[model samples]
Target: MTLQNDLQSALGFLNQGKFKQALKQSKGGMKRHKSHPDFPNIAGISLSGLGKHRDAIPYFKKALALAPGFHDARKNLAQTLLFLQQGEPAMKLLERVLKDQPGDQAALYLQAQAHLVMNAPEAAIVTATAALARDPRQPRMLRLRATAWNTLGDEKAALADYQAAVKVNPNDADALQNASLLLARLMRQDEATETARKAVAVAPQNVEARRRLASQLISNGDSAAARGQCLALMELDPKDTQVLEMLARISSRDQNAELLPVAQKALKAAAPRSLDRANVSFALARIADQAGDKEAFAAHNDEANACMAAQTPYDYEGSERQFSRIMAAFPDVITPAETAPEGPRPIYVVGMPRSGTTLTETVIGLHPDVFPLGERGVPAFLLHPCLDKDQDFTPEAARDFTADDISRLPEMPKGTRAYVDKMPDNYRLLGHLGTAYPDAQFVHLCRDPRDVALSIWRGYFSGSSLTYAYDLKAMAHRFNLYGRLMQHWRQVMPGRIYDLRYETFVADIEGESRKLADFCGLTWVEDMAHPERHEGQVLTLSNTQVRQTAHTRSIGKWEKYADVLAPFIDGLNPEIWPEIKG
Candidate 1:
């Protein structure tokens, strides 16, 4: 065959994704037409397509050597270098290409990717924005810019760009998946679930999309659907430890015996000291607990916690100092603002994780006049500049909140008297909340330290914020810090904060719920006592638990593992839990 015919055949094979065939055709063309840059460039493209990125580098270099001004070969080499994580060298080559062809969108997109690889998210945003300006319908550029925004912690901007990308290209499963995650994080459960469903429909075989859909289904209290998704995932990869863990989480007592053996197999296959191993161990612990085998439960629970602790060690002293600063910052009572911000009243439910915060919110949400906004980070996000820095927070920071800050809060439904913000970590931000909103009411949930610690240890937390939860000693220290901080708030804001003990609340649901309702200015209704009947979505770890009728089964649950929790029990400060005796 002639040189042109061979090159055309190779190009056609490359376009058809037949990488080996393309490589063979291009190799034959190179032998016939020696020193042809196009032949070497096409060979490099085929090699890169076949995942031989290292081997592709030398061919691109040869093409560039034969024709020094071959921009396509230079761009191809730059991309291969990026795949190899050599961002600096790749960046230099892209700059040269852009210098030669200033309006090349392909080079610009790759340059943005190189910026991301270099950890320069701001620079990536600039490059992506320029490309997007020229072509607003470019979904790739939109998604790239969205990623840069997410890296800079601007979730709203990231979400907007992601949604825009999906609008431009409806079948983009990756953009749909990312948008769904942002929606879930923003406490929009129904929307998140819907978006996840679209993603799964667009890419039926995508494991991550299926997993995301299952997680959203679980959050929305659809356990049966989540189990079905897990089963599908198992069919895709029978040995997937994550799928096994999800099955274990949503399994019923009757299903525990059936799932236990599968979870054990996954544990044996998991890597030592890895997150997957930790998750499998947690699953085994759950199975054992359901089967009423306390010894096995303790063994697996301890193993899971040990693996997590090795991965993320807590900074106890640093946390102690932070808590101390928070306490010192609010030495005196924060009087309500002279003019309360006019809008729906906010009921702040604050406590440690697994302290019945979700349960309390569920009961309150049963009132027709209340809207449940689950676990919003708006308060923390707005106050982060003041509180999360090296400097100590001052009373002046509270007064600095403006109309724009209040406008950023989630909108309330029509005719709603109040909304609940049930983020448990808001215990640390009571002073800011109280000073900013005159109509805001704080309800503090308190549970036994031992129960809370054990629950946290067994739970799978996703972020660095809860690193203290994996270790018994760190949990105890954090419990003490929380106790002291709550005491400070009580002393400073007398009559402003309501303390609701989980045990007490569960014992007399109607009577205690009546007081809670009255405190929040809601009329007494029978539905308030039956939170299980509430139709709103729950997006917390207690999603499934809160759907069941209120019970005291969880109270004093740590007693069953008393022998295993001896170290944790000894670490607790007596001052914090005067109820516990030696």
Candidate 2:
């Protein structure tokens, strides 16, 4: 074939995604035309298409060497560098391309991506916005800007851009998935689930889309559908440990004995002390627990916790120091604000994880006048930044959490007397929140430390913030800190805080729920006692549990595992629980 014919043939193959054929043709052309820039450029493009980014670099450089002003080769080289996460070098090359061709949308989009990879979301927003200005219908640019907006914590703006991107391309699974997450974050669970379904519908073969849909389904209490999604995911990647773990969770919840052997198989195949092992171990623990095999449950739970502790060791001393600082910062009684902030009053449900906070919030939300905002980070997000260098709460910090900051929270429905913020860790921020919202009521859920510790140990928490949950000693230390802080809050803010014992609340659901509703200044209703009847999403680890009727089954759950949790029980501070024999 002629030189031109060879180049055209290679280009055609590359355009059709026949990367191997393109590479062969391009190599043949390069043998005949040793100094041709197009041949090397085509070869580089083909190599990149074949996911050989490293190998493509030399060819792109050779093309650039033969033709110094080769914008296409330079752009291609920048993209390959980005694929390798070499953001700085990729950025410089893109800058050169944009300098030569200022209106190149392709280069602009890549520039935005490079900015994101380098952790410069603000720069990415600017670059992506400029590209979108040229064509508002560009879904890629819209999605890129939405990601930047999300990185900057502007969920509303992020949602808007994502929706715009979806409007431009209804089949854009990425935009749909992201929009669903933001929607869920904004307390719109139904919309989030629908959006996730749309994403799965459009990208049936996409594992991530399917996984997200399964998560939404699980959160929405559709376990059957979630299991179907998990089955599909298993078909997609039979060895995916995450899929196995997810299936195990669903199977445990449904008491599907068929998956017990599958989970065991995954556990055996997983690497020792690895996250995959840890996840599968947790799953196996759940299955064992469901099957009423105490020995197997203990063995699997111990292995899971051990693996997790190895991966993420807790800083007990650092946490103790932080607790000390928090206590010292609020040494004196904080008088509640005289005038309540002009918005929906907030009922803060604060406690340790698995301490009945979600149950309390669900019960409160059953009241017609209350809306549940599950585990919002707004209080900490607003207050932590205002803390003094010593990490002390300041009057200035209270003033800093102004009307504007309150606006960041989800809006309550009309006639709502108060909104529930059931973020358990917000207990640490009560000193600031109590001083900011005059009408705020604090419902502190107190569970038996043994039961709390057991529950926490049995479950897998996602973030580094909960590293303490993986070890017995760390759990005891954290419980002590929580106890100390709660005592301080009780002394400093007397009437504003309501201590609700989880056992007491569950035993007398109606009677205690009345007091809780009254404490929040909401008129007591019979519905408040039946949280299970409330048809709203529960998006916590205890989501499934909260959907069931209140039960005392978990009240003294630690008794069953007392022998296994001896260290944890012994480490508990007796002073915090005088009723228990340590």
Candidate 3:
């Protein structure tokens, strides 16, 4: 064929996805028109389509060298560089492309992708926002911006973008699944379940969509529906570790003994030292603990801890430094709040995780006039802003409270005389709470530290912020800080704070429940002792436990795992152990 005819044949073959034929035709055309940019560009396209990206690079360079102003060839080269993960070079080329054509949507999208691949999420957010400003209906651009926001730890912003993406394309599976997960993390379980269900409905054969639906179901406390979804995932892929682990958890919760072997068999057959194996091992540990197999429990618990700890080890020294700074500021900063109660007052129930914060809140929630805002994180948000340039708190910061600051606080339920904010970590922000809400009261829930540590270790927590729970020494450090901080609060705000010991409450439920009700300024009600009957959704790890009648069996539960826990709790203060053990 002649030069023009040969190029035409190659272009036709490329368009039809006959990459090998296109490459042969382009080579023949190169012999006739060796100086033409289109010949080399066609060859590059052929090689790229045939999955030979490295081989395609030289041809793209040759095309650009021959036709210095060929925009399409430059764009193709940038895309190829991005595919090879040479993001710096790809981004440089994209910057050149954008200088000429600032509104080039394709170049902007690739630039954003390159930034994200290089772990520069802030840059990606800027670039992706530009692309979306040009064409807001583009689902991929919306999803890209959502991912960048999530990487920046802005979940609400990320959720907003995901919602926008779903609205742009209701059938977009990625957007639907992402929005569902964010909703779940925000503890809007009912809405999360509906969104995840839509994802599954849109992409029925997608394994991840179904998995998200299953996980959301479990979080919403619908174990029965989650079990069905897990079974469906098994049909999709019998060896999915997540499916196996989830099945193990649901089976253990349901007391379905036979299903445990299915999970154990898959776990035993899995390769050693994998995260999947570690997770399943942890699941089996929980089952063993429930079955009273102490030896099995100890062995599996160790394996799981080693695996998880390797991934996210404890930072005991770092944590100690941070807590020391917070405590050191107490003498100057831990004073009374200046603002009076503008509306419904808030009573905080504060303590370590699994230290009866939920139980105390549940008991207090039974009072007809008290609204329990379960584990709301408003104070944590407020405290972060008051830190100085060195990230340390100062007395000056504490005293700067304004009545207008109450506007920033989370709104209490509309028609209640008083509300309970039962965030356990509020123990760390008692000083801030004291200054911002002078009328606010505090309830400190105290539990046996050994039992507290054991509970935290035995259960799995979702966030990296709780890294201390994954290791023993780290847990001891956490427990110690909590004890010292509570003592400081008692000294600083004596009569405004009330302490409810878990052991005492368990032994004398009526007396302790009445005391809790009275402390919150509510008249004692007989129903306060039967918190499980209060008809509210508890969205904590203790969701299952709180729904059952009060029981004392969890008292002294540390003794059962004493052998496994001795090494971890060994660093605990000798003086504190006696106080808790008594």
Q: Give per-residue lDDT, candidate 1, residue 312.
A: 93
Q: Please give the CA lDDT of all the candidate structures.
A: 0.86, 0.86, 0.78
Query: Local error of candidate 1 at 12, Å?
Result: 6.7
- Pairs of residues clashing in candidate 2: none
CA RMSD (A), model 1: 3.5
Clashes of each: 0, 0, 2
Writing each residue's lDDT as its tens digit, candidate 3 over 355-444 gives 988888888877777777677654565465443223444445554443433443433455677777788987887877777677888898
Off by over 4 Å in 3: 1-91, 110-130, 148-156, 184-187, 252-256, 269-271, 340-346, 365-389, 392-413, 416-421, 523-527, 534-539, 580-582
lDDT of 2 by residue, 368-393 (tens): 87889888865665565444347444
TM-scores for the candidates = 0.87, 0.90, 0.80
CA shift at 412, candidate 1, in angstroms?
3.0
Candidate 3 overall Cα lDDT vs. reference?
A: 0.78
- TM-score for candidate 3: 0.80
Instruction: Sort every candidate by TM-score, greatest first.
Output: 2, 1, 3
Give the best candidate by TM-score.
Answer: 2
lDDT of 1 by residue, 373-479 (tens): 88876677667765657454444555555354555555456898888889999998898788778888999998887888778877877777788888888887888
Output the lDDT of residue 59, model 2: 98
